[model samples]
Target: MSDVNQASQTLLDSNPASQRIPPSVFLLTGAVAVIGSNSLVLSPIAPEVAQSLGVSVPMVMSGTAAFGLGTAASALFLARHIDRIGAWRMLRIAFMLLTASLLVSAAAPVAFVLVAAQLGAGVAAGVALPAIYASAAAIAPPGRESKTVGIVLTGWTLSLVAGVSISAVLADWLDWRAVYGAVFLLAAGAFAVLVFNGHRDKVSTEPAALPLAALTIVGVRPLLLACGAFMTAFYGVYAYLGDHLHSVLGLPISANGLVTLVYGLGFGAAAFLDSLEKRVSPRLGLPAAFLAVALVYLLMAMENGTYGAILALAFLWGLANHLGLNLLIVRLTALEPGRRGAIMGLNSAVTYLAVFAGPLGFGWLYTTAGFGALAGLAVVLMVVAILAAYAAPSTPRN
Candidate 1:
């Protein structure tokens, strides 16, 4: 048999249905890392990127929204096609598109082009990420589905640590554009892996239509709302984090990487505690995490001018963020297994929707109301998420 056929046969021969995570899962996780990082890669140097592109920091921050816009559109439109087109092909396409977008971003001379490139990058991310989730769940051993998800999401967690920490320092030494160049190299590497993997994902065999099935999930509503709040609270500060540190707190640009590393370490660590959630109800665990995040936001806003507080608060936020968000994702994958692709697609759509709104809304608040106002609002949203999680039923839709 040919390599593609041989690879397909290998998948059948030792399917994850009967075993632990396939080694190939690591390859897909690498793809998730780069795609997840692309959305925030410029965040560490928002001011510098703004200056290079001849725009205000807020205007450059609008690129975050543009990315969300593109991703949301894709999550809505393209996710359904995953079953029809096949996951491997969609992943390949996502990889190529991301590579092209990164090149555009690295080479852009003006702000608009850069924003457009981010949008393109988001499109690639929208297609690739949910597909990975869907594929992971399908391939996971019966009881290990959520754990598989945790492993994949840890890629995102590590990327936040490694990508931000390294790129922030590089941006200081080289330039804002150097960050995209580095990501481009990484994306190119992922593409090469996909090319060599030589197996395609099987199409869904579900009875329900993607639209109707996705629309009808009872558990999804509360989860989506909670997720929206989660992203807004995060990107709200995250988009302007560099500015908050450098301009407001009077810290040097180098501090961004260090603080992000602290946050990412906490995030990465939380994955290990995934099994602990079984002891506590999600109703309790989820809301408690949200509450913790709200408290962190409140405290960070009220802190004195010390890196110690910033680092500690961020670590706490990262820990809670990882626990809550990954729990939601694992629950989502299990929510309506029949319509998983569409469900994940919708979940991703909501995520980007929140991302689109967070920076734009928070940027506006930062302009008018100040950082304290933003943090206070985050508290309110977390409270809302807490209530939603409580009100939302624990059972999946029928």
Candidate 2:
């Protein structure tokens, strides 16, 4: 047996029935809390930040793009290092860097400094995410890895909801800087948890090397295509929801928080059901979810519906996106067990690349062709994602 197996066996022997939360859960939740908080809070404060720094809203948004760029840039290198140094140790280093970056961003007095800090945070998140996924896969019981990962990842979705709603209220009462300050405190607390508990150790004797050959294989083609299309559509919708609601519906700024809360609720619900993947194949779940989202977007584009309808559609969109994302991670990790770290890192890299494109492309379309065009594009992308799912080969869980 491998070292990871040995460690898991020892734990199982010690506690026969209790479900032990893997160390990856804590680390991933902490890192995602930071990222999700920043993504949601900063969008609302873009105008304020621009005014404070003597820049344009586009420049403030560019910080988000730069952060995605940093994530994509570091993913491959971090994957290779994790293969050599072990996931837990790499995660500790990632948390340290992330904490430092959060502090720097909170203290930043200029746009350039804030951009640099966000970039660092993105790199840290990129490094941390794949390691977390791999660790979850390594520790989880057979037929339940997907559910375990979903539980861990739910922290991120929650952060997106809570971060935006709470930060919006805080920004109204206080200042945008206060939002970052709060997350800084949260990060500090997470760091304390890591120091006190110590990361879970894994055992493996295989040689560590880059999977350059695997990267070129046609086997992962369907998975990559699915991830790219899904991410592009998902982020395109999410990144601009606030602006879309305000512009198209003539809603107030506060409405963004409420709309996001609905979206978050939908995602949270789907995540709760994702643990049922052992009985249901993602192959069946994924396409159905996307088809539903496509219909919701179609409805939004066609009519200026009642507030109830709009909220329902937004929630459904969030639900579909989360289900697809969680399933994709589970599928890709299982594609090649030996190269789980590298494959997941590549997935993060590709997904972030899509994230970078989604906002820019959608924003351009929204500016030129109006909401109808954007909704039509989303329909087409969802169709492609569904087809990709159909084309992917099914892998059985061990």
Candidate 3:
């Protein structure tokens, strides 16, 4: 049998009818969609939520910051226990917390309550995200890990395309409270599916080590550095992208949404190429993905004067980003498969840290220098990521 066939057969032989593609991958994707949507939905609905709570928009926006703090703190301090606790069980608890958070937010009578609820949601996200990524790596068919993980990552695209937009519509027509209620329903549905059909996730019998210990493994640090730089670059540019379009290109808020829609489409479309990643060596593929992103940023910086060009580049940008993210997850999880929870927890921590730092750093550059300078900062970051990728220990092609 070929490698692909043999891998599939081995999966079936090892765990028949319990865990495989479609069902397993689909459930994980659904779970991620709920988590990703909750993280994003708050920003778009801040105005409505603020007005309803009788607070300023910025005060209401504190909910997002609270969520970010909770995610970063939980990922850094709490997620390591997934190794001792098991991804399946951690995911269960995370989902329960997430559902409760949404329920609280839906009924919150004050801004403080909303912020507190979102913080709880963030904690759930911190736990749920690593568990979901680790679980994807754990159950994937041997030779198809990249493709499987890529498929699961598309949940972000779904959240971007459907979740946030739908929330906006629901808030406009119904109520902002209804938006949280809807997300709560989605979370509850995913939790039900997880309870009934979720695959058993392996736990380390040895006590879970500190998240820092994952750094001791060779090649892990450089990969994480690359992960940090990659996320920072993307989020930095992304945070200001809509403002750039509106201020520079004279696009309205509605038109700005079109750019995000195009990006989401490209992100989802790139998943088809993930299967090809398995044929290429990580040493070659990893840097190549980073380079592609660098090129797109360069093009955007040079071509930002044109609305049409910026829109077109957004698609390419999303495409490159998805591939880069897929490689990061595949490579990181491959390094020490048994310690995936701890390692991915560190990944989540770095990611949330970027979510905080990126906007501030890039916002400064954007304010003082301009969009070109902001893109320049992104280019510099990507170059650093490229160098780190080159310095990373070379793994043999799977």
Among the numbered candidates, top TM-score falls to 1
Candidate 3 residues lying further than 4 Å off, grouped into runs, are 1-22, 42-63, 105-114, 168-178, 246-252
Itemize residue pairs with steric clashes in candidate 3. none
Off by over 4 Å in 1: 1-19, 205-213, 396-398
Query: Model 1 Cα RMSD, Å?
Result: 5.2
Candidate with more favorable, higher TM-score: 1 or 3: 1
Task: Please report the TM-score between candidate 2 and the true structure.
Answer: 0.88
Predicted candidate 3 versus true structure: per-residue lDDT over 303-328, tens digit per residue = 84887887799789888889998888
For residues 1-398, could you state the per-residue lDDT of candidate 1 as single tens digits?
89999898777657755666777778777888898668877777888888777889899888889999888888878887776677778889989999999999999899999999999988988888878888877777666776777788788776888787888898889998899899999999999989888886677564425553576777788888888888888888888777888888887777888888898899888877876866677557777777788888889778875888889988988888888776777778777676778888888888898879999989888888777778778888888888877776775311
What RMSD does model 2 have? 3.7
Error of 2 at 315 (Å): 1.6
Instruction: State the lDDT of candidate 2 residue by residue for 46-106, as single tens digits.
Output: 6556777898755766667667777776775666566667887777677788778878888
Candidate 2 residue runs with Cα over 4 Å from true position: 1-27, 203-208, 211-213, 216-218, 247-250, 275-279, 303-307
- Model 3 RMSD in Å is 4.0
lDDT of 3 at 386: 90
> On a 0 to 100 scale, what is the lDDT of residue 86 in model 1?
72
